[model samples]
Target chain A: MYERFWRLRGDKTTIIIPGWQSMSYLSDTSNICWFLEAEFAKEVVRLHKVVGNAVTEGRHIVVGTGSSQLILAALYALSSPDAHEPISVVSAAPYYSSYPSMADYQKSGLYKWAGDAESFDKEGPYIELVTSPNNPDGFRRRSMVNRSQGLLIHDLAYYWPQYTPISSPSDHDLTLFTVSKSTGHAGMRIGWALVKDKEVAKKMTKFIELNTIGVSKDSQLRAAKVLKAVSDSCEQENSKNEESFFKYSYKLMAQRWKQLREVVEAGELFTLPQFSPAFCTFFGQEMDPQPAFMWLKCEGDIEDCESFLRGHKVLTRSGKHFGASPKYVRISMLDTDETFIQLIDRLLAIQERE
Target chain B: MYERFWRLRGDKTTIIIPGWQSMSYLSDTSNICWFLEAEFAKEVVRLHKVVGNAVTEGRHIVVGTGSSQLILAALYALSSPDAHEPISVVSAAPYYSSYPSMADYQKSGLYKWAGDAESFDKEGPYIELVTSPNNPDGFRRRSMVNRSQGLLIHDLAYYWPQYTPISSPSDHDLTLFTVSKSTGHAGMRIGWALVKDKEVAKKMTKFIELNTIGVSKDSQLRAAKVLKAVSDSCEQENSKNEESFFKYSYKLMAQRWKQLREVVEAGELFTLPQFSPAFCTFFGQEMDPQPAFMWLKCEGDIEDCESFLRGHKVLTRSGKHFGASPKYVRISMLDTDETFIQLIDRLLAIQERE
Candidate 1:
């Protein structure tokens, strides 16, 4: 896990927050997102540049409690306030399970959930969430609607070099990234959006202001320090001798995927998505896509894959939650080593019974 | 002023967060509020017990990004899902300015802001916000509706002895508190709610889960440390040698209030609220109210009090924001020493101009 890299670094990545530091609600009052700490924004830009994941130049950064909040903020900003009805929000099938509920939980008049972007045929303005190297099923995706009326929110949570090949710097009107997925710091609850439109950015900032006042400054400072360490590890001279954070993470993912594939091949009871090798600009070589989740389909008459897996003492998200059939389930490839091993072992045991 | 106490404490109140710490989303998965950090919750309970401001026994603690988020969550939890229309949310006149916007920003179907709790006569399932030692005005409040159908959310953000007399340990069914107002750690963005009902607590937790997934574990841990330090300062058992956090804070507030009163008396243009001495259980003595804000009402001629003060280079929140007459303005008493002194000097200059 990424924890090992941080653990080895020791105090280099440790952040000491004095009691008097960042005691005010405002971080940079002049900034569009006033609550965003300047240092945290700087680090976000630096990390994206280093990874070649997203374009940050000329883009406004809006920090949030997490990408979850950002998702709703994007919906709120993109939707027409004066519209006759709530704007429809859609994501492709097998999308993030929480997306539908998050949009509709408030039952906001501004926006409402309209499931499965692929099948969406509404005649008005709509917000499409495009999660690349998507959750549940880790396939590279583009906006399915491909219509001028469709506003896009690109959730690039798993676009890091460790999970997939960095094709190019992603250019989008609105792109979201989280420290949780990139640095494995989920507990920090820090995420940001790179918005091209100033009006949209301001609206997003307003949403955050009305939501939680602002994101936590303590977490922001901590994130800044952690990100600095990450960038520092890769930029250091003679870094070839020391494994870079991405390089280390990439190797681990590759190993895990290799192990998982071999088990699946032996079991012959499930089918995992096949991804063709692609050249990674960051790594400067052809690399296999090692996604954070294994989208598994039950073979031959296994109608309920999630329930079947649970029977084997292996838990997974039912495809039903993702607006797909129960024959498919998504299992995380990013849990701790012990837990991952236990999952594989349980799967193998189920395979033996067949 | 409280910052001075924290700065003097040096490393004792400081929090050192390692890069590898709290990397997961879950804090205490077994608790009713799964995202609530055990340490933070423990410290919250400990602080409440130490201060005797609120009862913590058998109360479910739901942690949030801040009290702003908790306010929304309380509304979400208390509102009936089966209600024919959005539940009416009412607070007394000159209420916290943000309450209306925060409630209706999304134009949520669950609840709608109905201003001025004192005038709210509409029946059937209304939410009444009672902010004891209220924001802007600093007046003690009770639910004015006085009906069984009225659900109450007690915002105890300024209930500390430094702001007002802690007359009794508040035993409200749902009470909210924030570290920002209590400890002046606004940047931490931590708040907690003590809920008596199990279903309500779960619903509040669900609201948080959808809003941000969870509160920041880093901030929670930092808050835990800050609060522990606060309680420790009071329970040092050193024969009254060292000043407790509240004792030091109370002295600063008392002094500031005295100076402001003198300046206002000389100006003869602004009338400040009068407070009768009341017994404080924690302090074990009668004490005058020293609120975090100065609610100033213009005597005559100056119709727009906020604009009038702005002319004197003293920035204050206009009463219009709090749904009050332009003759009144709210000035913060919690700014830095330099800012407070500048405000006093500016007011003295205004008096001379008169």
Candidate 2:
């Protein structure tokens, strides 16, 4: 998908990690190397400013193998060692599916996975995962349980300018971001957390140390390169008409969303979520829907929308996987142009048959 | 130091990882990729055969970020979910210092770190960690506790040809190896486990997946290249005169051990452990002492050998840190040539003054 875009940029986005580089177990300054730490912090701050999604000031940045690892690390850091019982971990319904498995796989006595936040009534310390511009559904959300005793981990994975409007800079105690969704470099597996509390950061660092020693210096170096390229393109003057990464991503996603919605609307047998125009600070104008995923609800006796889509050879994640109704399904809008075209064609053919 | 040797080899040891080489979250295969996994397995088996140290036949190869992560993964896999209580984890005295901390850090309900294996009596089900060519003492060790309920995880980080003689092919159910000690690429942080049981391997795989998704593909690729280079060097008929990694490492370690022994013997204030010359299958001769660390015991009024060494501006890990007596200290024989020379000079000076 983005490979074409990256190819167009050629060596501008290229990174080369040399052998014998970072062979020492210890990083230069801190547990995380000074070069990597500095680059990550600077790029993250710059990206946030350019996108207007998250506030990065006064936050201790801890890097991980990916946001997936950091998610577990954050949970480990938040859970108290002295607690008599295991801390409960919860997220809202229709959440990212991997949350449950990752939290409980270790079967660590420190924390246990309790279901959705709405149903969790346990009287103890808990960590609520808040994924804004949620995975299954493309709606912005907030913590439903407003308790001082609970800690919130804001997983802002899909809150970049390409997926959603930059309504405001999210100010949270602990927030996670990854290069996967932001730059479509998921293979690199570089993710970071912005932690306000030093103690929490320290604990998270320990978790990372125990988990994989630390993130790969090579990956970190590459991530730093990719991030700098993105920031440079955005900051460069007269580059709006140029092939900027975000612009390319936003335009492609918006076009896909529009085409899919048009076909579904014509079908009249299914409906898509309605997202009105929203102000985007980065683009300096109102933007249409450009979600990472398209949430589709089956109408007129289509109980299993995922199965129905599969019948058309268009595979989608069943809504039941997200703790939602079977009538709904989540289709990724971020596939390659060819795949998206095939999806649109299949969807339109279904409408014609109906 | 090995840097001098590496400089001599020049770009032959160089590895360049491209920017977009491995960007997918998943590998080409399962926990590790097909190419890397096959290369690692083949190289590991070949190396073991060359060194005649560990049995690789009928073993399942599991790669990790490092042997450190695999240490915890092994413990997690060995501990049963239905166990009446947390499984006890024990290692012999002068064990790897990080074992206790790594085992109990998560405060996992699955396992608890018990003290040295010699005093472990209350254990119903236990996992005994056996680090052959042990960390501080550098002695080949076996599990003292011969109980049916006790499982063993052999940390073979020091089992390479440079550190110890190839006595026999160790046929342990669970054995851990790392690239750090083997190739002096400690920065790469690649490790592997040779497991005899499929169930245990599956559990370990699950643990890694839940931990960091998996080890870095970039690191894995680099490791494969390094391992292949090592194997190629060792297998070549006339390569003994060439820059073979093991040959170079052995020569450096053997020389360092001899020099350090001479100085300590002249000092008379400290006594080093006496290791008898053993026949090495790899070298096909009775090799001189080449332990990774010099276990120095204070002979006179020096109750704290580590402090005495520190007073002379030589930094060495304290014996107490490895669950040994303060009278003993462990000096690394793997330091840079300059550092080692300075250490020898300091020791000779102290002896001359005394």
TM-score of each candidate's B chain against the true B chain = 0.98, 0.94
Q: Per-residue lDDT for B164-280 in model 2, tens only?
A: 887788899999999888887776668999999988988888787777777776667777777777777787737456856778889889889888889988868989888888888
Pull out the clashing pairs in model 1: B91-B117
Give the Cα lDDT of each candidate: 0.92, 0.81
Using lDDT as the measure, the top candidate is 1
Model 1, span B54-170: residue lDDT tens: 999989999999999999999999987677899999999888999999988899999999999888899788999999999889989898888989999999999998999999999
User: Could you tell me which 10 consecutive residues in candidate 1 chain B have the lowest summed lDDT?
Assistant: B233-242
- List iRMS (one decimal) for every candidate: 0.9, 2.1
User: Distance (Å) between predicted and true CA of B243, model 2?
Assistant: 2.5
Per residue, candidate 2 scores C-alpha lDDT tens digits across A16-107 of: 54445566666645633222456666788888887778888888888887798899889989998888888989999888878888877667
> After superposition, which runs of candidate 2 have C-alpha atoms over 4 Å from their true positions?
A30-42, A237-241, A266-270, A299-316, A335-354, B30-52, B237-241, B348-354
**Model 2 alpha-carbon miss at residue A72, Å:** 2.1
What 10-residue stretch in candidate 2 chain A is worst by lDDT? Answer: A28-37
